[model samples]
Target: MVTVILTMNLSARFTVQGSGFQSSRREKYGNVFKTHLLGRPLIRVTGAENVRKILMGEHHLVSTEWPRSTRMLLGPNTVANSIGDIHRNKRKVFSKIFSHEALESYLPKIQLVIQDTLRAWSSHPEAINVYQEAQKLTFRMAIRVLLGFSIPEEDLGHLFEVYQQFVENVFSLPVDLPFSGYRRGIQARQTLQKGLEKAIREKLQCTQGKDYSDALDILIESSKEHGKEMTMQELKDGTLELIFAAYATTASASTSLIMQLLKHPAEVMRLFTPISGGYRTVLQTFELDGFQIPKGWSVMYSIRDTHDTAPVFKDVNVFDPDRFGQARSEDKDGRFHYLPFGGGVRTCLGKHLAKLFLKVLAVELASTSRFELATRTFPRITLVPVLHPVDGLSVKFFGLDSNQNKILPETEAMLSATV
Candidate 1:
């Protein structure tokens, strides 16, 4: 009967976090429970020890896995679509682009992009969706950093329209039937790939022994240096993956970050990270919290649950950035307790760059202008792929001059008081 009930709710976003899952967190179903998703029976591992083991034991115990729809979205030969040695090799090459030196080089460019974008938004003088705007900002940055092209704002906006089709179809049903979302995604992928190939060709032709300091150059250089040259197809696929990751994940987080900040207006929101969950296919029969997980069974970890429940986190739903302060240090619970950036060897490689982007954007916003929420209510958010406010939280923008560091005191107080 319990299995029947769990199976019923496993579809869609319910497996990891659907409606009413929280109420059942301590319902004696145990830490690791068997459930089904997309018609396949799987294990949902909510135990801290189980999460730690699967993450830490990446190779010996289990292999990295993703839903079929997700893999189709990420494309072939990308890190997210590969496992073990292949993933490691691609990661090594990709690391060069996200390296400290690379990110440092990218700062000035990103700042320019943000400054220009915000200035454009300031001219509107009305409520605007920060979530949608942030996607454009990140998209411009992604193109510049990944493909080594500083596209003009008009061209960038146009390109986003072209890119939007691909983005809409990523997690669609994986089938080649005509007029299907998957088919549309594949077509969009081809269109984008052709564009990337053209850019790569142009970049290569103009390389007169000059270092451009971008992902394109890094990838082109690393292909030969690592003893195994990446095929042009692989490079193109990786480029797509980079662009998607840079845009999608960060956009979602930025939307959520802004909403959270608005919620806690008086507090200094210091950091934000890509909070995600993933799949681990069991290599062999395993005992997790006394539950037998069979071979080839899908085991999904819930980052939401991990951070929401205690003895792990106190006042779980409360928004308190000071938990990481020197006095509290609440993240010291255990190794796998707080995983905003995930854990284990398969942890996100772009985490450093992501952190830098978010922190810098937050600082830029605070230092530049004072903005107020257009509405007092929180926007609806969907959690299937990433957490993002559905309506793209509207904000009234107000740009400041060089001398102005803060908004009017009354305005600031009112923003908080209304919430």
Candidate 2:
């Protein structure tokens, strides 16, 4: 057993060394010895059964150590590090704000924010860094949708810098040195906490009925109901925790989606073509060729590998949205195969909202503009706290002609009906 473990550890190390992304590590290892690792079983997850069990049955068995790296940045009791009934209660409270009704109410506001961000991009040089733009859009959305306030540009810049520092240290060696990234992350947490405390205090004094109807309202109301209202410190940490959760994941996924589309022009055109069948194809292509994730692992699903797996996709590596449209029934069993937001009980609570946000943004961008990758060479993929194209996704966006800008009445009607 020791020899088997040791060999597996060495193999895993070599695999990771060869591919910075975990999905690539799994692909390199194939189905052999999926278990075994070095260090404390930091995130010991395997197989779909194991994943389901941990995520659903014995979830508490898994520690929130992964987020401890951000504890200083997010408060200790922030939802990410929260456990047991408290976590569940908090989730329940927040769920109300994320419901379809709540989201629909916020749709017009969301559309306005997205449009403004896109308009800003329109005036810039044609080849814009889409990764950066996506981050900005998501960041702005988080503030407006969850915090109920618009962050000033200067404050947004400072906050993002601190956030970036904290994210960079999430997997760093568990040591704090003067001026090191981990130490900086700890300091950043302190700054964020102070800001959050002030905000919570202000919210506490507001007329109850006049409170902003964002996630903050839900959290405050829930805390009050339990007679365990968040203290200034708790409020600060919790807010940051929520923002980080929504921001980083969405930003990363959106960036990856765009990159995938750009890499396959045919798929991009097919995806945007006006056809009921084409829409489904875009969804499938997004699933396959986007990521490969192991069934039972509790880690973030690898959209890249899940998108490229041979068993789930015909030419898993190649971008082909048609597969999704034509093969929906065939891919039914593979629904859980491409979980960009994770799966089971722990699946992203904000998934529907995220999808709505993505769909609307995609509709707006594809319909009103023509865009393409400006670079001929594939940019190196970098894991900068989140996956990003190393060179940044520079693309030229051409505004649609007046006639081309005419909304597809059916599509507009569909979106409105959903709203």
Candidate 3:
């Protein structure tokens, strides 16, 4: 059985190549197949109904579980690592932070960050790497807008450096030998936690009566209001988790958004899946599509595969914005057909903020600049951890005049006018 599974997995990997591994596997093995990944037997499920069962099942049939490396690095207190009441409570506290009111408060800052970052990127003598810049941009948003930090430039740069280490190793092997990625990740996590603890202490001491609208303030206040005050350790874990959750996913999405924009100008809708899939640990033995999903095994629902194989979507590979329009309404064909933000209780808490950020970016990019791929061939996407270009997506930006016709070198006036 293991040999057959390995063969199937290898076949899937080779067949998919640049397209996607899971989608190709689905085509070969139907909507359900067992494959080993991250040192565990995983049943990879796709199709709307199959994925819907796993997603909607939540605590009853399955529970959220990332790899060992992720679990260890993210710690025990985060919403991603918790289950049952703990997850519920943490999510409740976080939901308030991403509320429409909170997002409204964050819009100006998000816009300012995007505007400034674009100007900086465009000022470069050569084409800027979209993925690299997007990472920096989202990191700034995470630090300044979400956590509301006002640290010195040196400290911010150091934090970002440490954070890159943390992110790079989150998906590494569980081995913690000295100088291993996991060991480095553990060390980086400690550094981040210390920084976050100091920030939390400063906030508590200096801003007791102040009116701040950032996520950290709201998180602290919301936790207290729930009558279950988070401990210093919990606060640190939560803050780090927020940063981790917000950083790479948004960066990857931002890059993917830009890529899609360049290819299909009218397809501004988020067809790119930043997160390839979500993981769940089976809590009970259940029959899915006549196959027994044994308890204690892992189940991975592929978001990208679901999107690809969805019969609701005509020309699934094509970027068609009209599919989402009222006349077509393809996404509405099924509950779980198009879940960029996932579904059920564990839906991404940052979905609203992410979409809003991308929307503002798209509007700003269209209004302020004319961008094109720096290279003749578009870069291929790497889908593990998150979806981003393998080459970091080199793009050159030129300023758009008031008429949105003439393209010139980006200048301060052109960038300032967009805001």
Among these predicted structures, which one has the highest lDDT?
3
Q: What would the per-residue lDDT of candidate 3 be over residues 1-419, giving only the tens digit for each residue?
A: 12124225432353237345665667777777888765667788888898889998999999999999999999988899999988898899999999999998888778877877776666666898899889888988888788877666688888999999999889887998999999999999999989988877876776543334789889989989999788999889888988887899889988988888898765533367887689999999887776778889888898877887888889977877888889989888889999988899999999999889989999888877788899999987777667778889999886665343332444323322322
Whole-model lDDT values for every prediction? 0.69, 0.55, 0.81
Model 1 per-residue lDDT tens digits across residues 139-203: 87788655766345476677687677788777666777999877888788888888777766677
Candidate 1's TM-score:
0.87
TM-score result, candidate 2: 0.75
- Highest TM-score among the candidates is held by which one? 3
Clashes of 3: 0
- Output the better candidate (2/3) by TM-score: 3
Per-model TM-score on C-alpha atoms? 0.87, 0.75, 0.91
Tens-place lDDT digits, model 2, residues 238-329: 67777776676677666666776565532432111111000000111111122332323323223334334435556655666666575463
Kindly indicate the candidate among 2 and 3 with the higher lDDT. Answer: 3
Lowest lDDT sum, 10 consecutive residues, model 2, at 274-283
Cα lDDT, model 1, residue 154: 76
Clashing pairs in 1: none
